[model samples]
Target: MTASLPVAPDARQKPVIAVVGPTGTGKSDLAIALAQRLGGECINADSMQFYRGMDIGTAKLAEDEMGGVPHHLLDILDVTDEASVAVFQRQARELFDEVRARGNYPILVGGSGLYVRAALDHLEFPDTDPAVRARLEAELQERGRGVLHARLAELDPASAQRVNDDRRLVRALEVIEVTGRPFSSFMPVRQYVQPAIQIGLNGPRELLHERLHQRVVKMAEVGLLNEVAELETRGLRQGKTASRAIGYREFLKVLDSQRGVLQEEYSVADAITDTVVATRQFARRQITWFSADERVRWIDFTDPASLSHALRAVTDA
Candidate 1:
């Protein structure tokens, strides 16, 4: 049974509401419910969901699932385009204002922790030097990702732990080299740029892990391979961000096996297993990221009163 969400009182100022948590924690469903109750629009904070052809693996909501609510920022980029946090911050802030201007609450949703912070927090990015970046990229190619990551870990351990991909790893090292400052120093403070409420959904670790595995299996069953194959033709392999996505990356190995590009045959079952492992790891990282922020009000995702609890957080804010 679902608890009824309380009606939002009429007020001149509506706080920005953020639905944040790990993957497969029902963030999107809760976001839609909040939007329906609060007369709000959802602005996506998921970095991968921005890619157009990534629907199945990313678990993107179809039109019918949106429940007639306006959703922003999903499918805004092609798979080949790299996602930029600075660019996303600017665009999301603009949407926040626009949504509020129309007398609607802005509901930000996704498990991408940094993206969520960029949308709501007082964060700033350092300028990048093309020469320095080129040098670093060349170094990465020559020395390999492990070597560069080790160097970054030595320079800024916090940034090293937070950065999960080669692109971000390179960028962190670039920031250290160019600005003479640790990349972690530029991370957002807990303070929000505007009045906001963050509702976090979490459950038992075992339950979350099981759900992630089931979801990966379901995605594979529902044409995730075909989706990856189609995107590969559209330059998904060349995409610095998209190519590294959990499920897509695993499935691409199967595609390579099919094409005889690799000596070993990678099966669909192999892809599913790898994807489940990667997704669970990613979810753990997300939990760590969001849990560190004390401002987030957590509710048990499995609880029947979760929606009502989330609504109360918004109303109390």
Candidate 2:
């Protein structure tokens, strides 16, 4: 089948099919089913789902849910391990190469827009300095996020514009600590790394919001609380990066509420409701993140014909 993909100099590097969209858009289902049909293997591009023991809350697919299709990059990390985009990009490329070596199509699937973009663009990022990061983190804790963000705006307007207020401020401060240079100065020009057939599944905002709500409800039904309980029992704290994953952090607040800690008078039910709302907000941010990339071929997901149309484009090339 001809895949309508960007041209690559070598046929040895197999073409990729990236299934991307907001959370609860059925991207994983489509990618797995497609892999089953087309001799493909799926690789995760999600940031949060990598953590072990986070299955129910992260909406990570179970082994049976995978429908016997081989998958990569899921449950490969501990909660304490920090997974960076550069590291993910490198491992994802290796997985892509391995999949192609086996003569199978590589299907990349997730809602993490940054990870997807990093993989597609072959982005090169600067090395991280632990001492620098530690100092910046300490400063942020003491000085506040607004102060750091203001500093970033002065030093690197372009990077500041692209990143979220929280992450940009933290990273900008780290860069200043490390090199005494602005974070914007290290930005690399992107180079396309693969011949990829892109397909986006997007619906109206209301529909997406509803879907996100329903997905959260499903998570609750399927033992999300138990998952959080296990993590808490393992001594995962709210301040840690892994504990700060959307679901984990919110549920931790719920636990604290039980202990009379939250001053906002949150309860278990309130926590659940707020978590669902926050997840919807996260999906909105994901949409904004993906929209910034011009190379993706977008499709309105409500149309039943959209997937077929995208597949046709993939095969027509």
Candidate 3:
């Protein structure tokens, strides 16, 4: 909102383009190319990539991989620090505005459903009570996800239907208990805080499946296990949020095999398989969430035409 900064004349009044879709769909690559064409910098909205030592597991790009484009909000949190959508909403908006004010474009890129919306939409987060959250989380651990999910189903069926994970279900229950409103009621209206465009990348399900499978295999082959082991030394296991990331958690279980603590037998290949399956499922959920938004201009990630399509969406917007 400051008027002191020099705005580029070529910069349209309000242009923040968000590139989104499922994992393994090359959202980052598209964002980089889009940034190149638009003279923008990317701001990461991926929650896992916030951790400093979580590069390989999160599929973070190396500097050369970034194609000389600057990025923001990456590796800003320690593995032990909890990541919050509310906090990211505040920070990412600041970054977005700062980039835009100085005449550069702000390209928001990530598949983290809530963070992307939190930064660009008119969404507000209710305050949290740690005591209430702790109690609900304890209940979840003791009684299991099914019991808590059923309780949520009774209290707020719509929100319960949206989330099947234990942690998210617990958060929804906590929100409902604290605010006396269904979590789904907090869904943002189809309005942006600023003039913005959203582009989504999608491909055939079979292609996505293969892409994710191959990506997981590459991560495993390229020392994802070693990365997890090093993070364990830095307290990765103690962080409630980072400890549960898909690939990291699966590899952590494999790390547990180092001790005799695990009762079941497993291998690195089994860990890879679990990661691939979980990633595919996660991608499905992401697609479901993004597809519901009618405003997004979607492009096929497998098609070269999508580059031109995405470019047109930005230019026309």
- Give each model a TM-score: 0.84, 0.81, 0.84
What shift in Å separates residue 178 of candidate 2 from its native position after superposition? 6.7
Please provide, for model 1 over 46-73, each residue's C-alpha lDDT reduced to its tens digit, 9 standing for 90 to 100: 9999999999999999999999999999
TM-score of 2: 0.81
lDDT of 2 by residue, 1-317 (tens): 12233333453456788988788788888888678767889999998888888898888998989999999999877777777888888888777777776777889999888798788785557666888777777888899877777777787787678768565567666776677776777764455686787777788888888878777778777877778888887655742557878777877787787778878766657767888888888888878877876767788777877757667756864
Note the clash tally of each candidate: 0, 1, 0
In model 2, residue pairs whose N, Cα or C atoms come closer than 3 Å (at least 3 residues apart or on different chains), thus clashing, are: 2-317
Pick the winner on lDDT between candidates 2 and 3: 3
Residue 263 local lDDT, model 2:
80
**Between candidates 1 and 2, which one is better according to TM-score?**
1
Least accurate stretch of 10 residues (summed lDDT) in model 3?
Answer: 1-10
Candidate 3, residues 122-193: lDDT per residue as tens digits?
998986889999998888778888888888889988988899677788789888989999888887877899
Name the weakest run of 10 consecutive residues (lDDT summed) in model 1.
Answer: 1-10
What are the per-model C-alpha RMSD values against the true structure? 6.4, 5.4, 4.4
The model with the greatest lDDT is 1
